[model samples]
Target: MSDQELFYLLALLKVDGVGDIMAKKLLTHCGNAESVFKAKLNQIAAIDGVGSSLLKKIHDKSIFEKANEELEFIKSNNINVSFFQDENYPDRLKHCIDSPVLIFSSGNINLKNRKLISIVGTRQITSYGSEFCKKLIEDLVPLDPVIVSGFAYGVDIAAHQFAVENNLQTIGVLAHGLNQIYPKMHKKYVAKMEENGGFMTEFWSTSSPDKENFVRRNRIVAGMTEATIVIESADKGGSLITANLANDYNRDVFAVPGRVTDKYSQGCNNLIKTQKANVLTSAADLIYILNWDVESKSKAVQKQLFVELEPEEQKVYDFLLKNGKEILDFIALQCDFPIYKISGILLNMELKGVIRPLPGKLFEAI
Candidate 1:
């Protein structure tokens, strides 16, 4: 959008009683932010929840001054701003009701037609969590998913670091403005991160890393991605909040289960037990659940034509061949093998190009 358009959009957001939903309503009715300001009082009041008091606040001129200040910040710092309706805005995030009308970003970021997954967890990450996160990213490298996180310590940084080490794009959703980095310790990573993925935020330059900003920050982390994965989280923490936000958005949520005795695992364990998230045991689980492996099905089927299958592999392969395609649970039941055992067999078959995994646990003989 042009600077004049963004100036009006920024001003509209500053209106006292107007938030994302109300702002969207006004924009829909009036066509644009500038139009909303120029529209008659009756036109603005016609929108739902627009009381006389809000209508009166719409005329506040001070908001324009604030908007101009932010516009200057955007121009001077080379910050990139995305209006909600802009093509550059996150596609998934645009569908969210509470998404910010304008998001500020900096770096070399491109999410078009790309797979995005957020990996978040407790600030005090454990060795188990770290290893699981590392291996998960390594295994997922083949799929080349864009890794997203809050850029905090622990699982967030670990996820970003692994993505960088593996040469994958990773984005950090910050709680504060682009002008500064929180946990100042993380300042060192700013340059490297901006080189590939960069940072995103809805907060303005004047906004600080306040307590409430983090909660709002979590939504973007959850909203923009195709799925949110909790590598490890305490019974109560920011990651769980993000998981809930992902669920609210009707996005996939996965949590890594750990021992019940482990404090950090309790939140993830609870998420799985309550059916809020899928059980994420490995990269295969995510690949299988999300159908990332489906693209290789045709190739696997071609390879299966000449490859010899083992007796056990042949049995599973025959069942899949006849069934066409089936979920992992059903394959285990029909084949008379344990579910745990089926995964290993399936992997061997996958390597041999005998069968392929599909989304939502389905598997088929290639």
Candidate 2:
């Protein structure tokens, strides 16, 4: 479709109560956004949800003029827009019941990746959550999967940062419009992400970051990815909404196990116990659950044995290898080393491919 037509479709979406299903019905009857724009009051009133009241309001010339003005503003801002029927629209999200009719983007987006995993968790992530997110990203890096997450604090930030560091593409599905980044503190990381990956939203540039918008935003994250991973969430956290949405969308849901006594872990543990999400202890768990077929991942593991490491690094690696995965605190205790020193050694070992980090601040030998 032409740019003007696409803009008109997006404009229609901004109308109150004209959601995806209703808009689609109107489009089916009228043929396209242009046709809908040109429809008479009576013609519009024939469609579902288009009552005489809505039809009269839609027929007002002032509304169309305002829409046109908004279109002009969007054009002036150089924001990238996509309609539901466009070829570039993300296929994974297209089939969702509440899929947006238009999406505004401000970064490089590759929607064709076969493997997309979303990592979401509490904004107030503990050290355990951060470590879990870091290791999961590192393991998924070699598989060349596209990482998706919100650009919020905690697990979201860690996921995006690790993806960038590992040279993998990451997409931040924002709750607000592309006109600005939320949590303004993450502006630098958002800028860096635009250079490497991209940002996406259904809201217009003038749209505010309202509370309801975030609940709506989680659907996009859940719909666009092949799987959703909840790193660490409280019993009532928003990450649970995303996981439930993923399940509704027929996408895999994985939850990293956390201590039962910890408040932050209650959601994840509940999900696993209730069979709402698979118990994910490592990246390998995710790979298997999704049935990802990257032979290279296995080859990368087998390429070298006895990976070179410093004595301290080797100690950490040997300990993890022998004991399976262990949390940082536990590893430190086992190795009789200071927590700070053990952290440095583990990071070096991770870089040297001597071990792999798991979600929830755990590490295991490759």
Candidate 3:
């Protein structure tokens, strides 16, 4: 599509009473976005949701001029626009019921990766949730999965941080446009992501991050992945909305279990009990369900270790391998080193890619 056509399509998305479904119908009836803008009142009204009043409002030339101004504003910001028919549009989200007619993006737009997974959970996360997210990313990094999240606090931030630390690609789906990052504190992280991954949104640059927009954003998160995994959620958390949308999209849903008494875990346990989501026990379960080739991943892990580790780091590694997995306290005791010294050694070992730390203050030979 030409730049002018993309501008018109984005303008249609900003119109009142025009949603994805209706916009799609209008686009089908009229050949392209330019044709839709020039269509007669009766022609537009013939579509299902278009009424006489709506058609008259859409027919006003002033509205088209405002849309033109909006397009000019978008151009001034250097943002790229992708319509539904564009080859770079995400195919996974295209099949959804309310797929956006236009998407505004910055940075990479590759969605053909088969091992995409969406990690969603409560904004108010617990210590358990944070540890789970860290370990899960560490395991999946070896398999080279593309992590997707909302880039919100708690679980979302943890997921993105882990992905970056492990040098994996990740994508953040925003409720608002790319003009500003919500919560503002995440600006640095978002900038880093643009270099390594990308940011995507359905709304234009002027769209504000309103509460209602989040409900719309949740559908894209679910639609864009092969599976949705909820780490921790309350009974009525927004994570459940993504899981429900995943079910509607016929994508697999998985939930990590927590203590039944913990309020944060109630939603996940309930989802599993009601058969809405499968219970997730480990990273291996997700790999198996996705039918990824683990043997090749294992080989890659070995190669990474050989190339990344140094001689002194190999000494710490041999110690961990001889004793198997152990707690930091146990390792300190065995090595007869002070706690601070042991910590420094362990950190250096981790930096060299010699070993991995598991949840619950344990370390394991990688």
Q: Give the per-residue Cα lDDT of candidate 1 at 131.
A: 87
Supply the global lDDT for candidate 2. 0.80
Best of the two (1, 3) by lDDT: 1
- After best superposition, candidate 3 residue 18: deviation in angstroms? 0.9
lDDT of 1 at 174: 94
lDDT of 3 by residue, 296-326 (tens): 5444445462555555456566778998998
lDDT per model vs. reference: 0.90, 0.80, 0.79
In candidate 3, how many Å is residue 103 off? 1.1
Clash counts for all predictions: 0, 2, 0
Which candidate should be chosen as best, given TM-score against the real structure?
Answer: 1
For candidate 2, the per-residue lDDT at 149 reads: 93
- What order do candidates take by TM-score, descending? 1, 2, 3
